[model samples]
Target: MMWREKEQVLMFTFTFVIYAVCTIILFNIMYRTQPTPYMDEIFHIPQTQSYCKGNFTKWDPKITTPPGLYLSTVGVLVPLAQWLGWEVCEVYFLRLTNVFFVFGNFYLLYCLLLNLHPQISESKLLLSCLNLSIFPLTYFFVFLYYTDVGNLFFFLLMYTFHLQGQDLVAALFGVMAVFFRQTSIIWVFFVSMAAESSVYITMKRTKLEKKSSSLQFLKKFISTTAALPVHHKKQFVNVLIDILDTCGGYLLTAVGFIVFLYRNKGFALGDKDAHVLCFNVSQVCYFLGFVLVFCSPFLLSPGKVKKFISFCIKEWVLTAAVTAVMILVLEYLVQIHPYLLADNRHLTFYVWQRFLGRNSLLSCAFIPVYIFSGWTVLQTLQHKDSVWQLLYILCLVLSVVPQKLLEFRYFIIPYVLFRLNIQVNSYIQLFLEFSIYVFVNAFTLVLFLNKPFYWEGQSEIQRIMW
Candidate 1:
């Protein structure tokens, strides 16, 4: 009956309600369209059916997805069909494996949250919703009947192992993830190597016994440069500008050095010169990686720097960028293109119908989502959570593929969860984010349903589900 006790009870109820609402919404979306067989479902069902029927070659040998998924898929399908006196290709039964795997991933994510934050707060609830509401993850994998669900399961398990200090087990899982889809491993691995090196550098440096403030660093740098002899002042400024420009090419663009210096002033790590150095190094690595991923095309050239940038662009670069632009542009153009004098409709139809297609667009949108998912990878790196850092980095490295890559579901799951955890500090910011999320997801859901069915009537299995 005490006021404090009442407050505690109220908080508990509020958190529980938000969590329940998110969970229900996720499951409802996942299951409502369950009966619709996506194009990939045709491939998955046939492979699973063949495996259950003991026709090993029924699955594609060229399909080098992880062996664990194959074994588990078979295990789930074979025994259940016989016990229930249903065919392996049975529609409801066929999608069971995917549904189970999807839910299993959610449970794994919950466990991860529990481990990372033993005592949950409202932020935890918000983070949980942000993570679980990942439109791309569920949108791409759950309905498509792809190996992403299983791949994601293993990827999360890998993180769990690392968090639990089981490095060897995590490495094994990391390897399996690569086998599922090579690109997933590549993303995680790059982060791991980069973070490990950072920690090592941090360990070697002496810790600061007394830290100075950011204002102090700025004051000292400004006063020192200002007081320098007239000749040295310009030289010092030029040197500073050169350092920034040579480093990331970011200094030459937009607000450049001023903006960077201002941002780094806060991230300056007080008076610990060593910590400051290490932090700068880590920031450079992350910023470079980010720039390389997002804005590489702007910097492309034949030189060593540009070559490296081009290499980082990867084959999916065009697909990913174009897809994001197309989504934002398509609605506007769909009505006007047909009326254009040049028969722009023909051009649009050719591009959408024959070339890019719906499935390809899904894959393309999935790439940006997966890349954004790496926002968590950056946060984990900053926190220097060694276990997570290691697993995530390794996964990033091993999962990379050069072209037409679509099956990195494992990395996608952690990427989303990690991103959600990297929220800014404010109620207003959170509300704005939630509003944008609602609008985008609503639009995406509509887009997903309205697209022509690609798998229907493809085969007997397709009829039941697609």
Candidate 2:
């Protein structure tokens, strides 16, 4: 174990050297061509500058999320920048904060996989961690002033701590994550329940022992107890106590969120009008399809495709059920928020115009794609306990189902969470994933840098981004 841990360090260092070289190259491009705040960086950079300058009272109304990003920037990186003789308030320097966040995220993801998949080889874990770090949706913002990477840092930190059985520390970071984005509160409770489920599912295998999750696990354990006669009613009590212990801190975090809701009257601190809640179940389909495409390199390989086909044929009923449900979701629940229609500078706008939203038939044609994507993604998690799988589906629904907009950044955490848990067949699969990320990211950055266009009535040139 010690030698493998050392090997992991070596792997992390090797991966870091590659990622760091790429980040520096991207940073130079941004510095030379797009040094000023672009897009949402306009809001994020200025607000963080305010916090850095010790103006705590100033806030950006256009910023819907809380001040966690600003607080973290000012609290840690800002001072570090000063000590390093860097300009703490420059847009370029502020963007540098997330550059460092990239490093931190890489290490945190390494620790997370360490705790979650100790049986895996050091090299495989490194690839999974590095692949997620460079995932196109999240990686594009690494050289920009964005909260997505920073918030994800906290999210990964929270889950890593939870996996290590440091539940209270995990819960604290969960609150910090909520402070970064209101939607992150969903994952906060998700980590809580997932941790609880881990304890219950792994309980036998300690005794081996939620509403949906808790109640379902209880029913199974009760039935299994009746048959096995090892974990009795008394042992069940012990399992329940352990579950409560695991989830208690996150429950407090939820209470704090409730109190904020009661006092503030809603989830968003500002710009509630734009961030209004909606039941756009279509977003979930789009996300699943996005995940499928990214994972297609491995998942669409000949052997995997054959397996998928076999499963579909043998379990035709299940395949039909998934297809039918997707049909309903696409037909009635598809939504197109105004931003998607208006923002030509975003990749989603073109995606909507060209593929999914070009016509009703074109959109509905994606139902099969959604089903295949969803099935293959679920197949990756097949080795997990039934409760873990169930809770994962439930959490993805809660996280993805309510978005009123069609932003791919919202897909980042869910994709990372899903990708990290899946099995990899070979080094070739990991290489394929890395190859895809390189192609997409290289194309994206080249487009953004060389293909600048001016928006009507706006002075600064605009570049498309994910």
Candidate 3:
């Protein structure tokens, strides 16, 4: 067993070395192909460069997120660039900051997976870490000056620390994550619930059964907490301490966030008009479909499909009711944002035009797909803590349901969180997932590099991305 562990470590070393070299090569070609900052970089690069030059007062009104990305560049990456003699604030070098973040995020994910699944196979954890680091939505930002990579790093970091019982440190990182993206405050609350609910459930393990009524369950839960002496009283106390520490820290940060919201007048830092919350019911459905496709290795199987078919037959009435509700929601409440229609440069445009929005019937046809994906998503969480699953569903709905835009990039964090929680014991399935991810990455990267086209009136060469 000891030798097997060593072999796994050595294998990871080899795989990581190859992966790093290839990543550098691909990033090199990307930089060479488009020396100028493209798309969002047009806003991000200049703003960051200003901060690098000690011009902290400079602000980009069109940029919606906070100054966390730029501040990190000034505070950390610039000093590292000096040590390595790389040009400080050079566009290519500035973008290379994300490469550093990519490696760090991979290591954090490996640690997180091990923490979450200590008894799971080490080889499986390593593969999950590597594959998630290259997940296309997050991966595309690795070679560009974008906030997504850094935001993800801190997010995984925050959750890792929380799960490892470092509540104070977890809260610190959670605050940093909020700086990266305001929506992360929602996740801070999520981990807090997961922490407190975990202890409560652990204290009441055998006594609280699912058969009880909601009133009975409530009484049992309250009584269980009141009767902590039934278990290790000291253990329960320690957990309470941790929970309180986390909540206290988060509340301080939450206050700051509320103040920002009040002062800024809304969530979006700069572009308020474009980021309004709307009743986009199909948004969550679209996200679930993304999970089904991207998570095919874990979710798609003949056995599961056959079982779902049988279950559907048994639960036909339930399924029909769900489908009917979804169809009505899609028909009446699906709001087509002007950007999705006006922007032909985005992949969402074609997807909306040719597939989902082709006609009324075709759009409603996807209701069943949405239902199946939702089922698979819940199945992935079935083994997790019951409270955590409820929290997960609530947090996911809050994160994606109100988004007025159809950008898949918005779903990256939830996807990563979902992907990390699933158990994959089969080598065949893991490798198949890795293979498919590689294929998609290769295709998308090649398409972006080789298929530059001129937008109708814009002079900058346009390349498609998630």
Q: lDDT for every model? A: 0.45, 0.80, 0.82
State how far residue 186 of model 1 sits from its true place (Å).
Answer: 3.3
TM-scores for all candidates? 0.49, 0.89, 0.90
Residue-by-residue lDDT tens digits, candidate 3, 407-444: 88889888999888888868887888888888888877
Q: Between prediction 2 and prediction 3, which has the larger TM-score?
A: 3
Better of 1 and 3 by TM-score: 3
Best by lDDT: 3
- lDDT tens digits, residues 347-377, model 2? 9999999998898788888877787777777
Q: Give the TM-score of candidate 3.
A: 0.90
List per-candidate RMSD values in Å: 17.6, 4.0, 3.8
Model 2 stretches astray by more than 4 angstroms: 1-8, 81-87, 196-244
Candidates 1 and 2 compared: the better one by lDDT is 2
Candidate ordering by TM-score (highest first): 3, 2, 1
Scored by lDDT, model 3 comes in at 0.82
